[model samples]
Target: MTKEITVTINGEEHTHEVESRTLLVHFIREIAELTGTHIGCDTSSCGACTILIDGKSAKSCTILAVQVNGKNVTTVEGLATTEGVHPIQEGFKENHGLHCGFCTSGMMMRCVELLENNPNPTEEEIRWGISGNLCRCTGYNNIVKAVQYAGAKLRGDELPSTEPVFVE
Candidate 1:
């Protein structure tokens, strides 16, 4: 069976007729044409399909489009505004939090929620927070630093140096 659902994504309302089993991630990518949300694992184990639903982080692959009917969704594409890039995005770029970039979007979405909840998360806390999202590259150390950088920026603290640290 198909249902007509309207979901506001990035402040834009999208109405579409979708199948009962259509995943929210598919709706975002296929219907909304937001390709930033990747489909790494359909089972939701990879957290690659993560997105913000009503300002909360959720695995898009695990949610049905109908489940988010009349809800607001935020994909990675919505993170940046005309003013500048979101701190999380800048953190990733400055800290080299991503390598292949397959999981960058989802990682950023998760970080958005993490920073919202705890703007000054410790390194350990950031590690624990992003445990759900898996990134094959970057070895997670830089990812943690990226979160730290974003947290500092969000909290209006002194911004960390964006210089890339070289390792022997």
Candidate 2:
């Protein structure tokens, strides 16, 4: 059976007829044509399909498109403003939070929600917040730094140097 669902995505409203079994990730990627939300794992173990549903981080792969009817969804594409990239995206770029980028989009989306709930998260908190998302390439040291960078920027603190410091 097909169900008609209306969902606002990236600040735009989209209405489509989707099968009851349509996963939110598939609907976003295939029907809505937003491919930033990746499908690394059909299982919810990998958070590559993470997105903000009504300002909360959720694995889109585990959710049905029909379940999100009349709700607001924010993909990684919506994080940027007209001015420039989102602070979280900037953090990832500045700190090299991603190497392969398969998980970067979901990581960024989760960070968005993380910062929303706690503007200033400790190093441990940042790690715990992103524990759900996995990055196969990056060692996660830089990923923690990335979230720290965004926290500083969002707090209006002086931006730290992007250059990584190494002590041998």
Candidate 3:
């Protein structure tokens, strides 16, 4: 038997008929067609499948689709706008925060939710906050920088000069 549930994804309303075991990640990627949220380490060890569910960060793969009814979900794709990239996205880009880019989406979403609560986070706090998310590239130095960049942005100050320049 399939149960129907209503979820608002990226500001769009979607109704899906899913089984009790269906995961939010599968629904977001397959049903919603928003593939920015990747599934990795399905055991919930790696935070590769994080998304904002009702303004809080959650592991998408760990959540069943049928569990979210009348909830607002925001993935990495929803973070941007017609005006350009979201501040967190811009921060990651400016700080050279992404390489291979597998864990980036989850990191960005975490940062978004982090700033929503604590706009100014210390380096240690930021590091502790994202300890769940793993990145096999860039050694997370840039990721920390990226979160700091976003923190600065949320504080309504200049974003410490993040210019994207690719060298040949």
Candidate 4:
């Protein structure tokens, strides 16, 4: 039987009837029409479907829509503003954090949650936090740079203001 689910997405409350078996990713992408969350692997190996659930990073593909009822979800689409891009998004862009772009959303979302939880994470903490969000492209160097850039930006410090700063 289809079940009703109420969730807040990108700051908007949405109510819908979805199959209990519907994956959160499918609900976000197919029903809500938010395609920013991608489905890369079926066995939960890839973190491409990562999203901020209740201010924490969670894999949408592995989560059921009903599981997030009344919860807040933040997707890549919600990470920008009229002022400019969210620091994390800008960091990923400026640092070449993504190449194929398939894993960019997951990385950004992961870093978003990480920073919110710990704004001043060390390089080791950042590395540990993003360890689950794998990016085959760039060998994770750019990804690390992006996360650092975002951390610095969130702390009100000036970012390198350029693409791909030297190894720090």
Clashes (N, CA, C under 3 Å) per candidate: 0, 0, 0, 0
Q: Could you give candidate 4's per-residue lDDT for residues 82-103 as a string of tens digits?
A: 9989999888888888889998
Ranking by lDDT: 2, 1, 3, 4
Q: Which pairs of residues clash in candidate 1, taking residues 3 or more apart in a chain or in different chains?
A: none
Greater TM-score among 2 and 3 belongs to 2
lDDT of 3 by residue, 1-168 (tens): 689999999999999788878899999999999999999899888899999999999999999998888999999999989988998998998899998999999989988988888889888888888988999988787888888888888788877766544569
Error of 3 at 141 (Å): 0.9
Kindly list the per-residue Cα lDDT of model 1 for residues 1-168, writing each as its tens digit. 999999999999999999999999999999999999999988988899999999999999999999999999999999999999999998999999999999999999999999999889888889889999999988998898889898898888998887777899
TM-score of each: 0.96, 0.97, 0.94, 0.92
What's the lDDT for all of these models?
Answer: 0.94, 0.94, 0.90, 0.87
Relative to the unseen true structure, what is the C-alpha lDDT of residue 163 in candidate 3, on a scale of 0 to 100? Answer: 59
Shift of residue 18 alpha carbon in model 4, Å: 1.0
**In terms of lDDT, which candidate is stronger, 1 or 3?**
1
**24 Cα displacement, candidate 4 (Å):** 0.5
List, residue by residue over 54-166, the lDDT tens digit for candidate 2. 99999999999999999999999998999999999999999998899999999999999999999999999998999899899988988988999999999999887788869
Clashes of 2: 0
For candidate 2, list the clashing residue pairs, or say none: none
